[model samples]
Target: MKTHLYKMLLAAGIILFSISSCKKFGDTNIDPTRSSNMDPSVQLTTAQLRFSGDLNVNERTSFMMTMPLVQHIAGSYSNRWGGIYFNSPNVMGVLWEDSYGSDLVNIIDAVKRTTDVAAQSNLNAVCRIMKVYSFARMTDLYGDIPYSEAGLGIKAKFDTQAEIYDSFFRELTAASVQLNTARDAVKGDIFYNGDINAWKKFANSLHLRLAMRLVKINPTKAKTEAQLAFNAGVFTSNADICKTVHEDIQNPYEEVGKGNIKGNGVSASFFNGGAVPGRFTTPFLNQLNSTNDPRMKYMVKNYVDLPGGNPLNRIDITEPLLAVTGGYFGVNPGNYIWDDFKSAIAITVPGVGAYSALNNDQKAQPANFLLRFNAPFLHLTYAEVELLLAEATFRFGATFGGTASSHYQKGIEAAMLQLSLFPGGPTIPSTEINAFLQGNALIAGRELELINTQLWITLFLNGPEAYANWRRSGFPVLTPGTNAEEPGESLTIPRRFEYPYTEEEQNRVNFEKVLPALGGVDSWNGRVWWDKL
Candidate 1:
């Protein structure tokens, strides 16, 4: 009787515990869709953060890919499309998380919950700005994004790239007007720290950037928008520049792929001898060297030989292709690095390696920045404005006011000054800068290209904007890459990245609508709507 009683008690206890657990399992008393937890306004900042990474990758590849399309293209590789490279699948990952998965839902829900006049105004402005900014960037990158019906979950429909671009400007204008009105402080202005003035400036700067995009397709509209932005006093100087920052501490997604210790660990081939391991192309090296520009040191490391040193070629040695190709100091016959050097070093790198061998070297050069505290994301700067003025004056004459050459001179000076703001950035002597400009002054026929080219170099790390300007002015006199044998050899510069493959696969109906106009998934030669010229 005692044994049976004990067994019955044990069974009862188990059943009691199971029932209690089920009652509280999915009810933590917390809403997953709260704004503080996952608002689109906050989450979309990831896109802005990822922008810098993508810019760096694109800039690195453009030397061979896009630059070659124009002229004097130097690098040889299987990717003829200028290596429109992405460091991570994270761009899409972040997009999905922020848009459909959580952030978007929270932002819309917050807008619904807030009825207080001040709270509603603040929330609405933030949401509009973020949604517009996110959609603008997405459309800029891939084209034909879902705008009108986006973030509506399964009901979302793809919008035309052209239409989306139109909505972007309209939304920016509307948001700016809304922001201009009084309200409670913006609840979460991550980019600008809830500063209304800064947001206004950002909005206008974005306007300037978008307006410039219309250069080829709608010059009148572009000029009008630029003038309006100027009148509004957008981005008066470098302090107003915007950029994302990574904590000095490393996060899983923080460092470049091959270089991240947490990700790939260390390999001997990546740190051969004293070379920083990844050297730039000889032409790129030579150009900076010739310019005597100060930025070269900050931009590229000189491990093999310092700036004035010989161009060392590591051509000899009959080691296995993988081992030979993998060394930090040399290039192989067929342009193989990891493949040729595998015997010497066995490892796979997703991106760049650490400059120092230590895994947690606190002082390791930080990852090429996505954005940063000191370096602001440049919506537009005085330098760019000056360059535009220079070009406008030159092409349209005094009707546009300043002398082309004078405006050009100012533009160059502003660019030099802008570079000075970066850590270890170059310091051009005023005399040297003046001398360089005087020496390379643009003539009546060449002023337009000259001004645009200077603007191009100044706009480094800003790919989409620079590419748009290039489409407009056709400046800088670039030659196509050295390898003209690639299949798309006929074009001068890649128009845009082909839309992602997944877009066509998953969003078929919307994809079909735009298919007739698409240049195909592999075709970087297709131009954006603004690049009609």
Candidate 2:
């Protein structure tokens, strides 16, 4: 009887407590406002990190190497060259959207909220410059892109290519001027290490680059900007070249092994035992060989066994001679060895089957370059500017009344010297480069091609400017491969990438506003305002 009475009292107490707790549960929750107070600094940092990788991947694959297809030095599965088919059209659009939505917008927010006033100011300036640089590239590639209200979450609007270019120039100019202001340095600048002077120099170099780009359309203004940038003093040597470096481990947007979630990135070719070589077209290669250009050895490789020259197991044989009959190949022109003796460390093991079968560790590590690491990411080099001057002076030799050939030679020499600073040996030998110029009469018609071709080659990794120059001058006379998918089209080199998909879906109103001015919607062939040709 005592036990039964005790159990009954315990059950009654439990029920009473449960009823009271349920009534008060809603009142016990934390304030909703407290969640909003969470620090945004860490989130912004994460955005920056993501942007770095995104930029590196997009730059290396599509922009830097696409010309190989245009020039017919490389081949894909279809073996077509001269135009990049929309194999992965989304790659272009997604990158553009991410730049504004995921990267720049977050950066702007971080700059506004940073506790260190001086750091905050510099960060804002940096973001502005970066945005200008990025957007300028976007507009240059894809005729018109969303700009003015791009990163306003769901409230973004699209801007015209013309407007985008104008904004880029204006913002770049403003950022350059801002750099001149005496503000404390940005502490976490992974690119220039908080050096405002370096940032200023970079700004000026970029300004000069952008200005020079408009030479065909606005020579006078271009000349003025170039002169101003020159007078301000920009990068004169390789040390001033901007690039980002990477460690053996934590490399810039590179891939890791199987089951690795944090692997940087891997191209389709990387997964296969070999990389897709962006080989050269026959015409481009033949021209270089005919001139005995030194850069040929640096850029071409022979992976296949030559017909009747050597068998698969030939011992102590000479390197296979490659005739670029169709497409582009090779990672770095200099990476490949002409002979078996020169195979990479990982490829030397006889039983490993060949260089093609080597694992990631066994293969060559690609040097990831960015604006921060200065060996190769040249925004505006003194040599390039000098060459442009040479071209301009030569073009109007009648008015200038000087030996155009001399300036042309000087430009050639400077470009050749610039190659010496590449990760590998110089693309071309100085002697060969000089010999070619000497052999070819530097007349008006020939001289322009000569200067522009060299310029195109020197600015290899720099795609945006190179593409612009190609469209403007049509130098190097790229001949379409006979094996191109669109064989019927006449020497069709793509002028620009199509407008990103996001603009049509999200920013439809503003996108349509710029359509009439661009000839029509869905016109990838439309040229930027500055591209006079």
Off by over 4 Å in 2: 1-65, 78-88, 107-121, 180-182, 249-275, 304-382, 392-411, 417-442, 481-491
Candidate 2 lDDT, tens digit per residue, 1-533? 33432343233233223322332222111111112342233323333333333434444334333544345233333222223333344544544544443345544444445434554566556666665665566667766555665543344555665567566667667766766446755543434555677766777677766776777877777666666665566655555655332211222332221111111222222212223423344455566667766655555444332211211221211122122123222322211212112232223323334443211122111222211122334445555655665665654333322365665666566666665554443445566877767776566568678777777766655555677667766787764334332342323555666556655755567667777866876554566667766
Residue 303 deviation, candidate 1, in Å?
2.1
**TM-score, per-candidate, Cα-based:** 0.64, 0.68
- Model 2 shows how many backbone clashes? 27
Q: Residue 218: error of model 2 in Å?
A: 3.0
Superposition TM-score, candidate 1 onto the true structure: 0.64
Residue lDDT tens for model 1, 103-167: 33334444445424465575566566666665565465445655666544343566776676677
The per-model lDDT (C-alpha) reads 0.46, 0.48
Off by over 4 Å in 1: 1-41, 44-50, 53-117, 120-123, 249-301, 304-379, 392-406, 482-492, 519-522
